[model samples]
Target: MLPVVLPLPLYAADASNTMVVSAAPAASGLSELDTPAAVSVVSGDDMRQAAPRVNLSENLSSVPGLQIENRQNYAQDLQLSVRGFGSRSTFGVRGIRIYVDGIPATMPDGQGQTSNVDIGSIDHIEVLRGPFSALYGNSSGGVINIDTQTGQQPTTLEAGTWFGSYGSWRNSLKVSGATGDGTHAGDVNYTVSTSRFTTHGYRDHSGAEKNLANAKLGVRLDDASTLTLLFNSVHVKADDPGGLTPDMWRADPHQVASNVSIYNARKTVDQTQAGLHYVRQMGENDDLSVMMYAGIRETTQYQSLPASSQSSAAHPGGVIDLTRHYQGIDTRWTHRDTLFSIPVSFTGGVDYETMMERRKGYLNFSNNGTSTDYGVMGDMRRNERNLMWNLDPYLQTSWQLTNKLSLDAGLRYSSVYFDSNDYYITTGNGDDSGSTSYHRWLPAAALKYAFDDSWNAYLSAGRGFETPTINELAYRSGGVSGLNINLKPATSDTIELGTKKRIGNGLISAAVFQTDTQNEIVTDTSSNGRSTYKNAGQTRRRGLELGLDQQFAYDWRLKAAWTLLDARYRTNACGTANCDGNRIPGIARSMAYAGLEYAPEQGWYGGAEIRYMSDIAANDANSVKAPAYSITSLNTGYKWLLSNWTLDMFGRVDNLFDRNYIGSVIVNESNSRYYEPAPGRNYSVGLTVTYAFQ
Candidate 1:
């Protein structure tokens, strides 16, 4: 029954060590007590404490208003959503903006993936939820910003490894150091990290391998300027175990669909990206910052769609191949001055990003003169060249109107363009080339008042939008093979009331929010493993989120997060039996998490946690549901500090009760194959060794 705490800051073992984060444009450079947004920050050290630092779902479970479900299918990545915005994504991230080291991880088209992020070197992860997120531009239902560890004094070299059930293993190496304070001319600091992970998954025919490398080199050109270079690369190969029917899941959760093995359903990806960031302290009241980046990504996937489905000229084959080249730049200026005797800070910025892609589709089966071979790439059936770009200009400001009142506001104009050229026109297919563009104006503002030094309250409102992604626009109705240029963007207006309090040794953050949307994008039809989208009339969402972090006796700490969301379709013309007033599929109505830990830097430590999720609708019809479930986990570890060398070891056991439950669902899936079951009683043990150089 402890009170909630805002996710702004988490104090260290002692109350004096405070960690703050900058998660939004208008709230940047401000501490937890000064910001007017519901921002959550998780330190890397806290994230990796005696746990496997492989997936984002590990430590991020404590963040309220967010959901991440591990589908146990690496090919599809984690199912992550902020509030309910991204609950519909089947493959990648949507309706959210992601950034790493000041470089955009999400493309201009609003589609993104986290496969390239290296968890071993992360410094912190910040999440901004609700109204203020709109300032980040397109797809901005929320924002996730990740920063890597910076090189520091007393350089260190570390090696870490983990092994667990289902033949899972991960290994990593890291080295980081600094030449000076990293602020004066000629001062240099660098950090490099690399890792390899592999797993024989919990389900049949589900195996995956991943490799990652990350580097950051920073140099201070002068006292007022610093330049940084960042590089990242990732390679992943994984088996895609498609979803199963309810009966099949109940019979055997570990079993894959029959077509998975026959079609050799799998995916392979390779991505490499590099970027440069420059920061200058211009005079005493002005600052300048610039970022430029470029990257290329290639993906090949074999789907379980029936071979016969590709026989028609309008069908996009069962095998997909894509090569994309993308680049972007951002420049901004911030000025601080006094306006009408009030302290104010103003910032203006422009972001331009573009992507060029070559897409080809082929049949998964080949037929020679004599026989047919399944699970082999055949003649190309579809080919096209696609391009997408976005240009956005935004301005943000914060004013300290009085001793107890402050205001933060921003506006952004976002313009996006998409074009496609069909290159595989056959007899009936003809030409499917098309082009389209969209424009939106987003605005957000927040007003806050401090009740005292230990408490604050805020009211905020904003307008946001979500554009159809490239994948969402790749198909149309009637088995058509052209871009769904008719799809329109979904726009929404949101308002929130929140409070944050700093009690004796605990912190609480809580908020209640509601959003109304017009022209909500929804699944129109799904068949033969492909889905098309259309504008469903309207929707409404109201939710409450609460978080609490408290430091108690000894080295013990208590943490809890809870969310209650009521998301429903308000459109009477959804074209489905239950679409008018049904709960949104794939979104749980309630979620709760609580943990108790006795963690210390040295000696022995242990922790235990429990999580609960309410029933979830598995399809738009509401005919099937994933039953609510509760699970518990426990972990223990020991650390030894011996002079220059440090050794840490840990062990974890999940699903302590061996409960049977559904882990995630494939929404609106055809053939009634929407169930993805969870595993029971999994265990892992890990260790890390580090050597400090003086």
Candidate 2:
């Protein structure tokens, strides 16, 4: 039942093979050694061992009820959560559901961004937690799927670079191949990757730059058909180190915030995408699949609101702009026989998504006539045109029923819709315009038992929903300026119990869970930096999790994970006042990780790690906090295999003992500027060069 903990999974990049998880709705897809709920997988050579493969929190810290922060702000991105379900996101990623190869990097109103995942062309990463992730419809609460790296059989070329601590760097290039070996029928396969990154941040008006590109193509046509094509692009510009006031992070956790150098805060982005996938085999128990995608994105920001905070005519300014276009499609069908005699499978799908946006606002200050020019981009208060859409229909099933019992189930029927139009009318912002919609019917189930071959036990249940993101419906809880469109939608219910074992080369796991939510969507005020939201009545989350991984002597390995969460507010909470039962403001009531390794496959290699977090809760009258921290890290690497060329060298050190934490939090920042400081001792190094053609 889930948890091979974090090592053990590969379908390529062969870390001793094992993997199969198609976002787990099942019909044929399960592994974490026969999945039964919470899941994890990392691979891609453990995301480039001795990594600097650029953020994914550097290889997902041996996952355990996810929470990967790192607001070492690339202009706010990366602050994921699960279990406490996205912990009231402060920027991107909301309640999870992201995918890379089969397209969707979450949209259709849920907001997502991994700044274009390109872990140098990854090949694995699948996380799915709790009750089959609500069948992947709105805000699934957990689901991450990224897969890239396929274009096999010889022919290769790679180049890489790395550097770190404050002035950072990254560079990459890759090429892969394949052409015959698909059992005839016009074979083809390919891969391409590109990267560039730069940073000079660790606070102080943070800086950043990024560029990335990716491509994949496959075609096999004739033997049961296949086709694939995908492309990706991203561009970013950043500088926005704004958050810190717990006495300016105890008098300087890397300084910035003097209104962030007087409003020079920043952000910029551009994106491009493409996708298509198809597969067929319609005979012998049927099968079929299809996917399609499209994208466009643009963003601009610059906020540190102050020059009179846009002299309100119902101000919606401080500069922010957006443009978006999106698309999606999915179709699936699957079937297999036997029912009363057990042994079944079934799948059905339909998904459609859409987004269309154009939002604007300006005034970061500029007045000319002898005054003001703070960060330029003056006038034009706000304008809007937004639309969102979603439609889903799904079903999944599986059963074996004997020889150790098994079952899986799913159902989905999600719908979402929103529309807004406004066009900058003002005299106190008239013409507000709005629309709304939401619907749900998600269900899930699971059961598994297998006391024999390496133990297992499981149980699961589900239902989930969350829908408010248009930046939480743009502003209206009292500071009122249109579009909050009467917020409401945040349902939930979940349950889990798990167990796993395989103890020799080692693997062990445990879990216990609970969730119960209703309404639940807090934060109800923010003025200069603009934020507003409400709906909060009941909430709860209870958790416990643990994991371990092992191997010995023959190139040692060991890993560990732990989590315990409580997250609460079970009544009387909405924009403050007698919080009925606090905690749950930026979540974290325990977390831990451990790692050790001695890898092999050329020459000496090494690893070490430790992490812990606890203290967090910076609002909702829990007063304030963001302390509890422990960190340690170290890495080493070397590899060289001649013949066709291969070399890899690496190094790392982080925190080690430097400590002085608070790496993320901004929960109710009406100006208290909730911390975000992390980075004490740091270092990095890297190398990679490869060549092959056979």
Candidate 3:
């Protein structure tokens, strides 16, 4: 029997008014409320009240067991990791699945880039933790689901403007409305935003400029059903000042840019996405939801490094151009409350994706020549294409043995097929690749018991599986060596126990979990003097997470979360035994976050936040470690409410102390190292004025 803690006073409100649909019996797809799984929901009210500055990573730092590494340069990419997963990844998110209103935001190839989510349109965000996530088959770490608001009223308009330090300025406008009579309501929502952000940069030559836009529409059918359409896009242009070595960092943390130029180093990315979703109510106790989505992403980047600093001179001029395109489709069906006395729910889906990428090198005949004018003779063009398909089916059922005891069981089956081809233009050679297929069966079980309204405890066990990504598979190929087509899929089994308690006006939750993985994939650098993906024998990760949310008198609230992880490689078959007992690369052993907020009766509010992360190993060798760092932030706001109009103003200070740190570190095939750094201190202030009609 699980231990049950006291119920917090905040939960005493009317349960039927809860914003989360998954918590209600009408939504049968959910397994259990407190099933020992680390899950949390960020409500729309919280988001509006907090007024985040940049991306979701910054806003979600308060979530337990999650970490966001802001590589400072928007051109490179952001790193989001949970439960010690995806820490080693350099570009794009791995080991985690992202969903928007039940539609997968990540591509079918398991690579996710989420710069398109419009913060203004989001209704809420949900974070699901642990490897027992049979719901999403591709990743084992966690899942982040974002749901946007729809059909609020007949017509609504909102606009805002922001100005801040570093020559940063932003303008945003949104218009949403519903048409037709009550029986047939068609809704449309659109958002347009532009920002010109530049700084002398914490370091020299690190300035960046970006632009983003998103729009969506929803229709409600006469048959009590709904359909939604979405479109999102982003354009980012930035300068790359390059990374600093440890000695340089120790000497001058803000020192960047060895070869500063107006347009010498830069990156540009553009992406367009479209999706459709339909939901229908079949009966009093049954409902169905179907979703279909497709997206196209194109990115181009150029960087110039010092020729003497790099290990290999594929190009004597120290320059490289990278370009990629991605396209994919995802479809899913969700059914609720089907048959018998058993509460039954299930979700089944299929996905298909393709990617085309090429990288070229150029050498300059003279330093006086334009960067673009460099000669392209003997250029290397590596083309890789991946066709990936997967089908996932899952079933979940919950049984109520008594008023206080509940039993939940779930099972999922997955079938995956992948085909890859590589072409080399320099050697005028290419290879037609074969296809590989595999099947996985995962299961989960949980037991929850409630002693009273205030306390609950639960225990759960689940399994997860992941296949190698396209980038890792086609990274290196040659005359004597070939792709590792025989690579096995990584698998993990996890167990968790947790308890939640409500004491007075406060809520506290704690959980302990252990996950063991087999045939883990690790970067092997000992072979061919280049980094290659290899199957590590075995590994284990165990951790403890705690979360606290408290509301005191005078409208004051406090929230805090902490995570402690122990990640290690248990067994390895490398050329040397040095890899054994080493901590997993990229994963910090400890992370913590705390925030305090106060809202007085005078319509004034303010908050402060502190986040900290421990050091992380840069590679399997464990010879180098990224320094630990912490940051502080402050936010304050005021609102004035009149009879029919409302005005609000807010400001924030980020990286309050201007601490310097590296967000991510990577070593490429050339054995040359690169680091993505965190941004320096900055401030943003904005205002919103609204007029409502009764």
Best by TM-score: 1
* lDDT tens digits, residue span 28-61, model 2: 2444656787787776778789888988888787
Candidates in order, TM-scores: namely: 0.96, 0.34, 0.85
Q: Rate the local accuracy (lDDT) of all candidates.
A: 0.84, 0.81, 0.63
lDDT of 1 by residue, 123-239 (tens): 878888999888877887888888888798889999999999999999999999999997679999999999999999999988999999999999989988888899999999999
lDDT of 1 at 636: 98
By TM-score rank, best first, the candidates go: 1, 3, 2
Clashing pairs in 2: none
Candidate with more favorable, higher lDDT: 1 or 3:
1
Candidate 3, residues 1-694: lDDT per residue as tens digits?
0001100000111111111223212222222244445676675557665464346776787778887776665666677888877666666787787776555656545677667666766666777787445456676467777766654454656677777765666566666555644245553333333333344444556677656666667666645676667667777676666565667666765566454352356666777667776666665444455556666666655545433333242211334444555544444444444244544444444544444544444432124445433222223334445566666666555555455766666676767677765443333233535567768887877776787777888788888877777656654434323456767778888999888887767778888999898988777542322245778888899999999878899599898999999999898634475678888878889999999999774498899999998987776766778888999999999988886567778898988998877766653213334455666787888887666544
Candidate 1 stretches greater than 4 Å from native: 1-31, 480-482, 573-578
TM-score of model number 3: 0.85
**Better TM-score candidate (1, 3):** 1
**Best by the lDDT measure:** 1
Residue 203 lDDT in model 1? 95
Model 3 worst lDDT window (10 residues): 1-10
Backbone clash total, candidate 3: 7
